[model samples]
Target: MINWYPGHMAKAKEKLKENLKVVDVVIELLDARIPFSSRNPKFDSLIGDKKKVIVLNKMDLADKKITDIWVKRLSEEAPTVAINSLNGQRINLMISKVKNLMSDKLNQLKRQGRRKKPIRLMIIGVPNVGKSQLINQLCEYGSVKTGNKPGVTRGQQWIKMRKDLELLDTPGILWPRIDDEEISFKLAATGAVKEELYDSELVGYKLLKVLKDIISDTLEEQFDLSQVNNDTLELMEDIGRRRGCLMSGGKIDRERTGNIILNEFKSGKLGRISLEISSN
Candidate 1:
């Protein structure tokens, strides 16, 4: 169900490669909740040996313990900082980490008497991972348009933020296909993938199943169900009945119920959840 839509990917890769030569560091944004699923696999190969700071954006929505585990794992590879891009939380930490990571390069520039130039940074991430929102936080002002859905920034555009920083804004890109079915569902569940690419009912049902295993008690508490059910669809029906997502003839509107469940999960109304855990 993953749609490649390679035109943007190819263009992004080309533009990224061309710009990579000029940038001092790359701000690789990952959804704190789905660090594994939201990450573009090609990003590693595409950004080989480049100085990168992994900013785990939207940390506010993620489970703290799981996010801490992710930070520990990812920091082994690159400087990882957890942040909430929407309200500029921990943004300064990200800025400082970027500066710390680029210290050597900055020193080299100082040796050459060329500290006049800004540290060029390009923010890259999966769709809806808050690249634009992160940019706004960094600049402390709105510079790029942002949306909850994918592919808002359609072309390559550069924005000058801090006197010492310049950002290249590009449309969010995902791999044409995903190797793991679970990862695909996780991406679809987290709104990382386009709605049209996957069946919401299927993904929502899968989400409920996962929640049933991990946080069934929370579900029972949230939906006020007398008892949790093993059947995912039955649980959805129960939720629909509670949420009043009904159709004509008083039938459970599975579609709307599914959306409510997903939206609740996404909005953290259900609970702070982490879909992918560290293999370690």
Candidate 2:
């Protein structure tokens, strides 16, 4: 599945490059389940020589054990924090980490006898990874509308986070090309792309299969789906039957089955599951 970047994301990419010059630090948000896939490909180079704080967002929806693995893995590359963008949870820790990364920069300015300036940080992430949600949490008292749909943010804007820290929130950017099948599968599985990439039914079935393999009894417990002796398709059919998605001839309605499964997973009804696990 080769994913093409949308026109709107192209403008964000250009703006991201231009805004990099004014940023002293970068805060990149990655989906906790698929950290590598959630990252913007151009991030490292775009942030060159600047301090970075990689935030693994949506932690509540990911496997806690896998999240720990990613936290350790990413910490080796840069300072990493696992946070739930909702409820303003773990955001203060993120603020503290960013302040630490820019400590030297702040001291450098002081050495030059320059007045202290607000810590300038650029926030970047792929669409739907919770960058805007995190920003809204950090600036909850301020006027900002947060949504589940991607691309709600249209242009660049700066918001104050703390006494001496200013955040430049940019529109989320997806890369111009998606060349890896494994990555595409992971992204589609995780709801990163719009629902157009794959059949919703297929995606939902895939989610159930994945859940059966990893969490075992998770699907059965959540959806009241019974454990069946049959194969994956049969199990999906059972789910379809339970949900009353049946064709006129009495066949399971696959399309509705798919939508139900995918929606349930997205809404966290399938439980706190992570699609990807660490190799190490």
Candidate 3:
């Protein structure tokens, strides 16, 4: 369940309109695990006819098979690349791709005698998808503050990375409307939404159910279970037992176990898993 936009997010809509005209290209980041759900329906309308490139970040943490499927699926409209921004090495390739795609604008600027000016690119995405990290990586670990939590970027700020490239790092923005329940669940289950509204036990159970369908053997191995079981609760109990999360009276600490499972999944210890699968 996605919580509605906060008061701060309302201001983002105003800021978005404020800066839309100045941006030459829009680098919209999509979480590789939940491409469709992570996409804001209003993006096309918000971005208008501006050059758009979809950066599928956190590829290292997502199921490769599913990522490939999404790549093929999303390639129909925008140029898409699967990248791990934390690693830094993949960023150059991403920048090169963006530069190539925005060459028409570069030519137009050249004709106007402003070719040497850095290309202004606006980076926008939902909170916590590594947008700030990507910007710092692209600019060689420069001055912008980087944090694990969302909304570190505030107001309109320009950072010059290279002689020909400048970045306008804006705060992460979410849409005002989230109409799909399934999308909300996937987002919540994966911690792509906020953590305050999520119950670790519920999310873990949901994740186990999904893994059992897609990668049962991996899930079984990770939790040290001998066999795949029909019941999710039974599997979670086994996981808790293996992890030694027991209460004072020796009862299984389901909530603790759930937190551990979800943490491992978030940290990529449960291997690359994708909550949302793309339709062909």
Candidate 4:
């Protein structure tokens, strides 16, 4: 079992509940590559009765066909849009959907002859899922600090995007306990959890296992392997040898090799791969 709920995340969860009273809508960002595993199950209870717009970030790094399937499936539950935050793809469509969701409430307020208010949105997701980057793209400036690693944002801050739009950026929070091992591996593989918390070699091997089944041709082509074998460990060793991740005694440096594989996968050097696919 892999469990990592830090002190700050606990506090962040409480803060989110309290802040929920004020926000009008929730923008739940998810990793497009691992949509199922990236979602925190606790959010359903936490975001009770609030309108939600699911934004699948990092679409540029995920398989396009898989992402389109996910978008269609997820839209049945809420307004879903696939966006590449780094390049601002489909961002305008997201904003339009949010506005549409709130159109009724906005019209009601107008009927009462009340003053116009900004649409308060809270952005929530697992760590390093591109919440900060999404906010920056919406604002067209870097209003918050961002890093490739998890646990970058430690507090809540309100950002003004426009006269009628306001965004609340919250720290990424995970569930108290992740009982599912496959979910844990997916989280670790996608950088949702810190690299120091788990064994990278094991995660890398698991990643290879998934890739070999889904995109064996791409994997072999990327690593210059003649063929992909059933033994993932042997495949890792072969990759390490090809990439020169070796120790002084002619042994493969497993840690270094693991990091290399993970970095390449995360950076999309292994091609556009989606760890999870929509069944529909």
Candidate 5:
């Protein structure tokens, strides 16, 4: 039921298709915490036959065991590496993977005695998946605009990482429609979809429900709860009361409480958590 496809995203997808004709390798960035939901399903067609290196950005905020499972599973499809773009963790490994994917093509060009060309890479992903931060780390400087919210990068621009590396940074684009409600909530919970498009209280409630199933102990400890109540609304209300999100009549302010839970989860204050895990 949650759907948000801005007009710009449509145009961005077209631009991405056009730009793909010139790039040699595609860098598909994904959130380490929500890898499955963060992936734009349209990519399988959009990037057909192109060499790809999947970089699981924000590994620092994801559960290591789950992330490792994802890395292994996704590697069968394409070269993948888990990295924290903010601090450049495992960035070298990603670079190595990218180079390895292009090795055959580069060698073929060399055999023809042609001039060497910089490897052109197009970085694509959903918004707020750390694409810009990953570029900044690659360039070792702030080469592109970045923010914690979705839809920050709106246009395409080329950034030269080195003499042999050129990157095309594009706006994060989502599919025209998201039919799966659970996927929609996961996207919202992980900050992929814009906050203005969904109800925060509903997302908070859904997120609490998921945490209760997978990380009840950590959630309880973080919020100082004696025990996690099975009723999600009651759990949220308890959190609201503990965090002092009270109204004039001592009622729990649902909106403020929801935002508190969401912000804490996004900021990793709830501890390293992964909402999605590899089925394998």
Candidate 6:
């Protein structure tokens, strides 16, 4: 079970609600690999009636086919764009999409003689979904500091994106309660949730189990395993032995092996993997 409800997150929740009142649009960044798990459902109710854009980030680290499907499926609700924010891949297209989505709103402002003001935006997402990276790409500078771990952006920072656009960067907000096991595992697996909150062995086992079915070939290639097994524990043992993680009695060092599996998957060392499939 993954239980992570820091009291500080409540403050961030309030901050996002307050920031929404001033911004013209909400640009939500989600991990391309775990779109369903990464999405904070609270956003729909919190940013009510605000123009929203869905950015499927880390596209290169997710399955291209599923990412495409997600873009199409989510675009029905909001203007959606798939991008790898780390390298700014197709980030220009994202900018263009934002402009197009906001054109009607911008035109209304122009008619009211409000054309001189810059476009104000609020970016929110579950932790570690490339929110800061997208901000840097958009601003064309490393404005907001970024890190691999969650809870890195503890405070809100207002960043100017060129002369005509401004952004408010709030701490990434996750729903207070995550009841679904797979959602919990995916969030934990993607490094969106803090590592200390969940057990590494269980998460690694679940991740390995999923990959065993979805992308066994990738696992085989990465670990040089000639044969794969149905049980994640056995698979983990094989991986541990391959990686030379052993103890005095030559037992598989499960802790070290778990960390290795998680780190490799999170860093995309195993290959492009997507945890969620489109329901539609």
Highest lDDT, which number? 4
Candidate 4 residue-wise lDDT at 131: 91
Instruction: Write the residue-wise lDDT of candidate 5 on 67-165 in tens digits.
Output: 999999999999999999999889888888888988888899999999988899898999888888888887744578788788888877888795378
Q: Count the backbone clashes (under 3 Å) in each candidate.
A: 1, 1, 0, 0, 0, 0
lDDT of 4 at 210: 87
Scored against the true structure, residue 62 in model 2 reaches a CA lDDT of 86
Better of 1 and 2 by lDDT: 1
TM-score of each: 0.93, 0.93, 0.91, 0.95, 0.95, 0.95
Segments of candidate 4 deviating more than 4 angstroms: 140-142
For model 4, residues 111-142, the per-residue Cα lDDT tens digits are: 99999899999999999899988888877445
The stretch of ten residues in a row with the least summed lDDT in candidate 3 is 184-193
Candidate 2 pairs with clashing backbones: 201-258
Q: Considering TM-score, where higher is better, how would the candidates rank from best to worst?
A: 4, 5, 6, 1, 2, 3
lDDT-based ranking? 4, 5, 6, 1, 2, 3
Better of 2 and 3 by TM-score: 2
TM-score of 3: 0.91
Off by over 4 Å in 3: 111-115, 177-179
Global Cα RMSD, each model: 1.8, 1.9, 2.1, 1.6, 1.6, 1.6
TM-score of 4: 0.95
